[model samples]
Target: MIKQKRRYFSFLFVLPLLVVFLLAGCQLQDQFNAAMSRLAATQSVAGPTLEATKAATSEATVIATAAQTATAVANSTLVLWVPPQFDPNGETLTGKLFNQRLQQFEASFPEYTVEVRLKSENGRGGLLDSLSNASLAAPATLPSLVLLQYRDLESASLKGLIVPLDEDTLNVIGQNWLPYAGQLSEIQHNLFGVPFAGDALALVYRPAQTPYPPSTWQELSTQNLPILFPAADPDTLVVINIYQTAGGSLTDENGEPHLDTDPLLKTFSYFSNGAQSGAFPIWDTQLADFSSSWSLYQQQSSGYAIVWASQYLQGQLPGNELTSLPEINGQKITYAQGWLWAIPQGSSQSLEGARHLLDYLSEPEFVDQIDQLAGYLPVYQSGLDAQTNPDLKATLSELMNSAQPLPAGSTINSISPIMESSTLQIIKQQIDYIQAANAAANQFK
Candidate 1:
């Protein structure tokens, strides 16, 4: 019995150790299964995580590249060469309005910027003269665009300083422009510039003195009122006015001067008789430019005066009436000119950007605003239709429709001085009208 008890106690002790070993084995098996499950989950998720990370990195790279490209595009700029007459800092009304329009242009075109350089409109150090110098000195420094007078078109084109506008650009600009507007930019059947403003010769008189505006030269000659015009001015438009009214043309179909014609003779005769008869003011010889004649007229020195439409608009000639030139042979004729926008040769700006700015400037809305603000005749019919003053609109419409462009050619540069000298001689009684006409015409030959 004692031996049996000892064996039983030993067995119990061995049972506890075997139970502990079995528990440890179970724990090890459980740990192994959990580790296997974690490994399997990691393997399944790894491919998708890597792909998602790659997609995020690619998207970020694309976004960064797009931003860089946009920044580059936004940094582009356009440079414009304009006259101080349209100065933004000027005290004139047109100057103030021009600056406003410039601001609007800049705001509307956020992707591009504008830099303006002031240039002289006339004289030895004028815009074209400066451009010619720059072309010779440093062609690369030329402006992308230039504001030019209609008279400058012929010379600028001959010099190859400006580029002809493409057909696509012309088409986009549309065909609603005025007759003279298009004519100003048309050179050798090719379009070169865009017209911005229209100016014409018109008679300005105080309404109180002349309730009846003369429609014919006979009626005007009969009035006995002293007429004021820029007889001594270098611009030939005054001479052309009388010549054209008398059915004379300054240029032949080939753009050559036809100065000694019967029409010119008649025009000179009319002016000489009028001046000698005391119908035309003798003081006009002292008038150097339109401004001087305009000043004299403003002082009520004469009953009638020929002045530019631009001056009439600028002066706002209150209590004054505007009309076309006196009729000859029942036909009225006048000279019209324009300021044009043109791109210089070898512009650094991208064509797209330059075209965008040109398009913006030619918009009818902007043109209308310019008309209202500056008294410049609108280039578009829509602008004309928007005018609040019916009489002014009608007058401008009639003048715009009937007005002819000044003859454009190399000969044009010489035509003015010759005409001026002949007219001055006839008025001064130094030569008879026929002699003056013959002498002037011979110079063109």
Candidate 2:
């Protein structure tokens, strides 16, 4: 009986040790399986990875994943807001081309969906006012991207809405964009926005009619023909351009308003004296419609007209016979500046995504399409150089190289209204005075 009890106690102690060993073995197996599963996953994507492949993939996967994430994040649906200048449905050349390009952007980057909204505001639809109001109620109501006219930069920028581009972004843009674009990006030594389009203005003339582009006010007056230029509110910018070309200063060295009497007198005297002598076509009083001038040029009713580059190229202006503004004492002067594409500060999307879209839009492939259909010169040098069509290429090259960019700093817009009103007043006075002077001369004769 005593021997049987000793054996039972010894068996009880051994059984507990055996159970502990079994539990430890199961735990080790579970840990091993988990590690093996991770290894298998890495091997599948990493191509049967050996020890050497592990280090390489650590770096490679990091880079690959980063690139994929960037593309994916930016490719998510993008929304763009355009002003009335672009009509997606109109038969206008700019309208047709912009739509096609929008399609192309979607096709090329399928990861991204682009939605373009055209908000047509009448003359009173102040972009700044509308955008400011929308942003307040629903901040997301503002589109991820906005198209701003070159003239509107101040009102837009001053509202603390535009984001400053960093060094990396500027580097990529510098590699791919035009000279003027990069230069304009820097505002007071800090870069703010990228230039998207140039609405350049030059003298549009019929080579057969004039035989020579007018170089001076004296030459233009001597032609004994009607000279035309845009002066209406839609194209009121022409007044500013003419003032600049005639040696009038829009802004002083320190960026102060400098639209003075001397410059106004010079500009008005040229037009008023010409009008009184019947040198200007009295019938062509309005410059609101480019077609009017185009009709005149095409019908040989006028020798020369000043027009926007886009109008001149797209047949909106009559004379296919075109040339740049003639030199004033051997110096070329033209008015040029247009809308720029930008993502406003505090927009819905991340800054990097906004920048990526900007980079894509400014790409050579996209810009060439815009240039081809719209007849606007490509702001990208690479795109312009890559232009294959002989006629289109030749025309754009001549304009881009010779064209002058308009100065569109903040001070310029603030004083434009004043300048416009003052200039017109001066012109009216000069015309009345010149008419009286001419009548007196006739009486004496």
User: Among these predicted structures, which one has the highest TM-score?
Assistant: 1
Candidate 1 clash pair list: none
Pick out the ten consecutive residues of candidate 2 with the lowest summed lDDT.
Answer: 436-445
Model 1 CA deviation exceeding 4 Å by range = 1-75, 89-108, 170-172, 252-255, 442-445
Q: Once superposed on the true structure, which residue ranges of model 2 sit more than 4 Å away at CA?
A: 1-75, 83-111, 121-130, 170-172, 183-189, 232-236, 260-265, 282-300, 316-319, 386-445
Give me the displacement of residue 399 in model 1, in angstroms. 1.2
lDDT of each: 0.76, 0.61
User: Candidate 2 on 1-445: residue-level lDDT in tens?
Assistant: 4444544665575566556656888766666567556644644544333545787879999999999999876647778777766655668767787777767776776666777777643234455555666667767667777777654554567667776667675435566666655555555556666666665666676655676677776567556767665444343565555566666666667766665445455555665666665555555445555556656666665567766777776654444455666545455566566667767766775455456667676666666667656666567787677778675567566655655555565544565555444334434444353333333223312
Q: What TM-score would each prediction reach against the true structure? A: 0.79, 0.67
Q: How good is model 2 by TM-score?
A: 0.67
All models, RMSD in angstroms: 12.4, 12.1
lDDT of 1 by residue, 1-445 (tens): 4444544665575555555656788766665566556655665666677778899999999999999988777546777787776666788877787777778887987778877888889777677887777777877667767888877765787788889899675443545787777777787777788887778888887778788788877667556677888787867567777777888767767777767568878788777877767766578777778888788888874488888888888768668878777888978888777778888877666667778778777777776676667767777777888888898888888888778777665556668888888777777777888888887777766
